[model samples]
Target chain A: MGLVNSIFATVQFEILRVLTLRRLSVAVIMALFPPTMIFWLQAGGALASPGFIITLFCGMVCLLSLLLWSTSNVYAELEGKSWAFITSRPYGRWSILFGKFLVAFLVSFIISWIALSLCMLVTGDLDFNILNDGKEVPKMQVWLALSGLLFLASMVYAAIFSLLGVLIQRRAMAIAVVFFTVVEVVFAVIPAVVGKFAMSFHMFCLLTHWVGWVPPSAGQDEDANEILQDFLNVYGRQDAWVHLAVIFAMTLLSLSLAAYVICKREYITLEDSQV
Target chain B: MIEFHNVTKLYKTVIGVNDISLKIEPGVYGLLGPNGSGKTTFINLVMGQLRPSMGHLSVFGMDPWQNDGLLNRIGLCPAIQAHYPFISGLKWVAYLTQLRGFSRKQSHQMAAESLAVVGMEYAMNRAMSSYSLGMRQRTVLAQSIAHKPELLILDEPFNGLDPKGRYEMTVFLKSWVKEGRSVILASHILHEVESLNPSLLLVSGGRLLASGSPQQVRSIIANCPNSVRVRCRQTAELAALVTGNFEIKSISINSEAEELEIESMNPLELLKLLPGLAMKNNLLISELRSSDDSLQNIFSMLMLIHRGGMRLPE
Candidate 1:
């Protein structure tokens, strides 16, 4: 009960403080950048298909959520020495870690939902007739299934990044920059099937097929029979569930390990020489 | 009450605390140590922020580690002055109280009362960033006392206070003891602890040196003879006459002033013989003051003895 109160106190304070800061406003704006660009490109006929646009937007949302929760919020808290005050409370260290994870995940989830909503509104891709009209529109059931999968994936991604934020000091910014600039771009260019290891890849795969916002790839029509076989092999088989389970398990393991490390490790003394 | 049975805390290759055993009962107690002498580490151990690597520690009859109920009865004011930058002092105090399970209204009331106790009510509504160092220290103290804890541990509570502020804190702490509450005040400023009149616990190099009443610890030093400075017109004759005749250990002439310092083991005898000695020498005595009995000198002597004892090559 005390741990719950402490967690609520920590999260409430963090959310309020983060919202009040102008830098968070800037981060929110940055999160919208990719979706906005995709919208403009789709309107200008820059994309080969609408399916690509939806995939890119969903991928960006996932990436933005990962970056915002892991880098901006985590770095700000560490620099402010707010964790010292939070950890000093009677709550166990696990409660603190879980509280931070909850805040980061919720914030990222909300931001992604907002971005997704905006993309849907701008693209006018929510029409149910598109699927019945033989436009290869994903069934509503598939969309719901994909949304659940993405939500779980986003939670796992946020947890992993938050743990990374705690373990590595002063690396949040550099990691975020490198992730967005080099790693994300490189992963995006790789074939979608090969991109499953990247969180963005799985998110994009689920989003593109579920929403009619983007059309199927050029080669997908030629290989429709092969694609169906592949989709069944990938999603119908137990491998996909295993992948989700592994990611969830990794998230839980990282969070628990991070909590253990934080609970045991001492804060560097003020008298020590700075790096 | 707090008890440490041979508690030791090591930080990697460094020794934060070593084989420290002591029992503290209800009353104000001062933890006197220099910087990096593990005062904060010791406080952390008591607060369960750090676990002991050896021996055992318990507060309020429960192991501080994994004991939330026991921690509920204790409060800590850390040495660092950093606070959540976004909240007012009142809100910070109220927030902490709420986390401790008080209702919002009760927490607010407690915050106001604690702030009043620290004499920081006027600045309670202001953002913590706007507070001065002394004001921040007072706010920290207010938060520590917000829950009316039985055991209030303050690490360097007097660090940034001015003389008046220090005096106010001293009076507040004395009142706390009057309520039968215990406080563990850690500070390097011996004079500040002296003003608190707490049972002294001296520590050096992660080792407990002495733990007892201030006077008891002061007596542990080798006998420091009381010295008297006397300004007399016939200083040369009086100095020569007083030397080697009346248990006077030594006499020294003040280089910058017309004064003589008479060192003696017995200050009462020296005082009684001063008039006769001055009359015999035909000297007019103007001023007299004794030097070795002050708390500062006693503390220095005690520290010297402690260091000397530690240096016996054990």
Candidate 2:
């Protein structure tokens, strides 16, 4: 109960901090990026396909925003000379970590949702009456499913970035960008067992399952069918529940590791006065 | 309620505090030292923000490192200034109070009360950037005291405060000590802590040079050798006369500046003899200066004495 109160207080402070005009404006600007990109693509006569939206637009925005907010959780306080004040409080470090993680996930997820809403409004993708596997599948349903998966992805990524912040205090953001490029982007696409370790791989796997991938008609596109088969083989044609379980486990594991590392680590903020 | 058992903290090649072993009872203490003399390092170690590189330290009978519960009883008004420009003093204090596990309403009330005690009730609603340095200092003090910690560790708490603020802070600390709570006040200036009449802990070069009451430390400083630099018309005559009559430790004559630097065992007695000796010799003394007046020199002398004791075969 005491820990809960501490976390709640920290959450309140974090919310107050985010609600400031400057920070809110930044958040709004970041949220507008994905929708603006979709609008630009639509103006160029490109289809706002579910696969493109899920993989490129929503995924990139979530990762970037989470990286921006979550990867500096500890570093920002240390740099601002507020770490001593906070860390000296009872249960302060743990509460602040959980509070910041919660806020980071919420802000990133909201940004993605706002971007999706604007994308739907600008591109008219909401009234998606496209057909899949001889059944009329609304693009709106696919988007909603993608949003759910994006929520889970945001939680996992926030935990991962926050853990990175704790582990690498000074260069957390730079290192996280590298991790994104190397692991999420490169390793996730590799056709090997290592791909399964990437959070993006499981997100894509779940995306493929939730939004049914309608294969090309028999004999209509042999090449496309082969490519689809190979892609499925790489990502694995796992059940949606299995992918969901994987994401849940990944989020739990990341959060647990972050908590353990944060609690054990000593943040030495070398201020001018400390000398 | 604090103990350091041969504890040392090293910052790579530089040492923060070296082999410091002492126990602090429940009372106000002045951790006195010059700037960069490891007073902040000692406070950091006690606050559990630092881990000793060697030996052991305990507060409230438990190892202070990572001891969250123990920190509930300790508050620190650090030397560094607060940098939250956009937030009001009230909100900042309240936010930190909430971090102490209080309800939102309760934290606000407690923050307000603490700010009021520190004479910041009016400007608590203003942004911190708009505050004077003294206001910021008081706000930081409010945060440290809001939780009513049993032990308050303040690092240079009087850095930017005016005389009035200093008096109030001293009064508050005196009352706090009277309540049986312990206060460890760290300052580079001697008189800042002298007002509180705290037990003195003189530190220099990361080592505990001396520990005693204010009077005790002052008596030791009195006994330390005093050097007086006298500029006079009869430099050689005065140096010889002073050396002959009094127990002058050393003398150096500077012909260029017409100055005679004299080290005296008893400065009071030498100062008394200077006028009569100068009148008798018909020497006009232009200037008189004492080297032991500055705080740094006093600490250096104490350090020398400490080193001498350490050099003795154990």
Question: What TM-score do all the candidates reach, one by one?
Answer: 0.77, 0.90
State the lDDT of candidate 1 residue by residue for A75-184, as single tens digits. Answer: 45446655444455566355556767787777766666666556555655533332312465654443454456547656876776766666665777567657545544
Evaluate candidate 1 by giving its C-alpha RMSD to the native, one decimal. 5.7
User: Tens digit of lDDT per residue, candidate 2, span A169-269?
Assistant: 89999999999889988999899988988888787677556655433332223453466568987666888788788888987888888888888776776
Model 1 per-residue lDDT at A50: 44
Off by over 4 Å in 2: A46-55, A125-131, A134-136, A214-226, A272-274, B229-237, B249-260, B265-289, B309-314
Q: Give a tens-digit lDDT track for model 2, residues B57-173.
A: 999899888888788789889987896656789998988888777888898999999999889999999989899999999999999999898999999998898998888888888
Best by lDDT: 2
Show where candidate 1 strays beyond 4 Å.
Answer: A39-45, A49-79, A82-84, A92-95, A124-134, A138-150, A165-275, B101-106, B218-304, B307-314
Docking class of 1: acceptable
lDDT of 2 at A16: 71
- Taken over the whole model, the C-alpha lDDT of each candidate is 0.68, 0.81
